[model samples]
Target: MVDFQERDTKRGLREDQEAAHEGPAAEGDGAADEGAPPPGDGEAEIDEVRQQLEERPESDGGQKAHPDESAADPGDDGDHDDHGHEDHGHDHHHHEHDLDELGAAVVTVSSSRTLADDPSGDHVVEALVDAGHDVVTRELIPDDYDDVQHTVDSLVRRSDVDVVVTTGGTGVTPDDRTPEAVRPLFEKELPGFGELFRRYSYGEIGTRVVGTRATAGIIDGVPVFCFPGSTDAVQLGVEEIVVEEAPHLAGLAQRDADEE
Candidate 1:
C-alpha cells in the first residue's frame, strides 16, 4: 500500500511538471504545443498592420483604391494613361499625358462676340469648366486668317493656356482659313481628332461634314482643339474626348512645361 501511494505521488508530480511546461494560455485548450505562438502574437501582428496604415496617407483602413483617387498610390497608373499616348509599360486604352498641363484654358474664335455670345462657344466653355478646368481667356476675333492665327500664337507662346478651344471658321468658306493659319503653328497635328469628329458628324450631315475642318494639335506646350461653328459639334468633341482625356493629357503637357 505504501509503495502504491509513492507511485501515485510521482505520477501526480509528473503531470504537474507537464502542465508547468506549457504556457499559461494553453492550459484551458486541448492538445496545445508548449512552443505555440503566444497569445500576444495576435495583438502584435495587428499592431504591425496598424502601423502600415499610419505610414500611408492614402490608405483608408487597409482598403485598396483606384488610380484616379490618389496619384501616390502604386496601384494608380496615372490619369493620363487613357489613349496609350506614351509608353507607360502598360497597354492603355486612351491617350496618356505627353504634357504636364493638368488644368485647361479656353479660347473661342468669333467676330463681334465674346464667350457670352455663341451658344456653341458657350457650351464649349461650359463643358471645359464642368470638366474641372479653367478658362484663362476668351475672345471674339473676326474669322480672318491673320486674326485667328495671331490669337492662337499669343496663347501658345505666352504659355497662358493649356488647351485652346476655337470655334467657327472651320468650313469651306473664304474665311475658313483656320486650318491654314493654325497648321503652321502646330508642333504635332492630331489627325485622328479631325477624322473622328468628322466620322461622328457623318451620320448627321453625311458628306457635309467633309466641308468641316475641325481639328486638334499640340503647339508649344498647349493642346488646341478646333471645332465646327455648331454647338452640337463642340459638344461632341468635348464630351467624347476632352472631358474624359483632358485631365491626364494636360498633366503630361504640364510635365513637359515643368522640365523646360
Candidate 2:
C-alpha cells in the first residue's frame, strides 16, 4: 500500500508538470501573436500599395492610363492633330472663286521705252504667263495722258482681255500721268490694291514708297493694275500682289456680267 501511494504521488507530480508545460506553451504562442501585425493589417497594406500604384500617372511610368491613349476607344492610335477642321468642302472655302487662269494684256507707258526697250513690260508679261495666264497682247505707249487713256480703254473693251496691266508714269513727277489717265476710267476703285502695293514696296525701297503713284481699279467689268516703270516695282507688283489676286479679281469683276 505504501508503494501504491508513492506511485500515485509520482503520477500526480508528472501530470502537474505536464499541465504547467502546456500552459506555458499556450502563453508563448500568445506572445508570438503579439509580435505579429493585427488581423487584416498585412493584406490592407498590400491593397493600399496597389491603390497608390493605380492612382499614379502613366507619364510617371505607372500602371495608370495615358490621357491621350485610351484602351476603350480602339481607334485611338495616339495620333492627335490640333488643327482638325470641319468637313473639307469647296463651298465653305475662304477663297470664293475657282478660276485657274485668265487673259492678261501688258501696256508700257514711257516716252523713251519702245516695245523693244521695255524691260518692265517684259517682266510683267513673263510673270503673268508663268503664273498660268496668257499674255494675249502687249503694247508700248508714250506717257501722253491721252495715249495711256486710249490704250487702256481699248484693252479693257476687248472681250478676250480679263485684266489690263500698265507699267510706267506712276510717280509724283509732272510726266507721271498713268494714274491720272487710268483713274477716270474705273467703274470701281480698289483702294486696298494701292495700300498693299505701298505696304510691300515700303519693304524694298523703304520710305521712298511715298512717291509711288501705283494704283488699281475695275473698269467695264475688267480689272486694271497700274505699276511704276522700274523693274523692281514691276517685280513686286506682279509677283507679290497681282499674280496671287488676278484670278480672284477677275472672277469678282465678271460676276455681275456672268449673272446678267
Candidate 3:
C-alpha cells in the first residue's frame, strides 16, 4: 500500500508539471499568432500602387501638361526646374501692373470711313473703355502714308496718350502703307506682336493671313499697335493680343523711357 501511494503521488506531480508547461506554451503560441501580420496585408499592395503611380511615364497613356504649365499655374511655386526654366527667367506677372488705368488714342486710317461709319475704330474705343482705359483722342485720318505718320506722331507726343492703336491701312493693297508710315517712328519694334497676331489670324483666315501687316512698337514712350480695317481683324487683335498684353507692354515701354 505504501509503494502504491508513493507511485500515485509521483504520477500526479508529473501530470501537474506537464499541464503547467503545456498551458504556458499553448498561450504563448496563441499570442504570437495574434500579434503576427495577416498574410497578404494592404501595406505591400499600397506600396505597389504608389510605385506604379510614381514610375508611370507621361507617354504611357498619361496626361502631360505644357512646358510652361508650371509657370502658368498661379498656385505653383516658381522653383528652378531641371527643364531649365528658372523662376526669375520670366515674369508672367508683368501684366498685373501699369495697365490698370491707361490713356489711349485711336487712329482710324481709312479715307472712306467717317467716325459714324468706322466700325473697327468704334470697336477699339469701346474695348479700351470697357477695360477701364481712357481714350484720350479718336481720329479718322486718310490712308495716305504722310497723314498716318503725322497723326501717330502727334498722338504719341500728347501727355494723355500712353498707347496708340491704329486700325486700317495694314492690308496688302496700294494704300496699305501703315507699316511704312509707323516703322520709321518706332524706337523699338515688338516683332513678337506681329508674329503672334499672324499666328492667331492664321487660325481664322488660314493662309491669307500672310497678307496682313499687323504690327506693334514703342514710339517715344507710347506703345503703338496697328491692326487691319476689318471688324473681325480688329476684334481678333484687340481681344486676343492687345487687350491682354498692352498694359504690360506700356509698362515696359515706360520703364525703358524712364531708364533712358
Best by lDDT: 2
Evaluated at residue 16, the lDDT of candidate 1 is 62
In candidate 1, which residue ranges exceed 4 Å CA deviation? Answer: 1-102, 112-114
How much is the lDDT of residue 187 in candidate 1?
81
Point out the worst 10-residue segment of candidate 1 by lDDT. Answer: 93-102
lDDT of each: 0.73, 0.85, 0.83
TM-score of each: 0.59, 0.66, 0.64
- The residue-by-residue lDDT of candidate 2 on 100-199, one tens digit each, is 7788999998898788888999899999989999999999888899999999999999989999999999998899999998999999999999999999
* lDDT tens readout by residue for model 3, 116-165: 99999989998988888999899998899999999999999998888999
How many clashes show up in model 2? 0
Residue ranges of candidate 3 with Cα displaced over 4 Å:
1-97, 256-260
RMSD of model 1 against the true structure: 20.8
Model 2, residue pairs in steric clash: none
Of candidates 3 and 1, the better by lDDT: 3
TM-score comparison, 1 vs 2, better candidate: 2
- Give candidate 2 regions above 4 Å deviation: 1-96
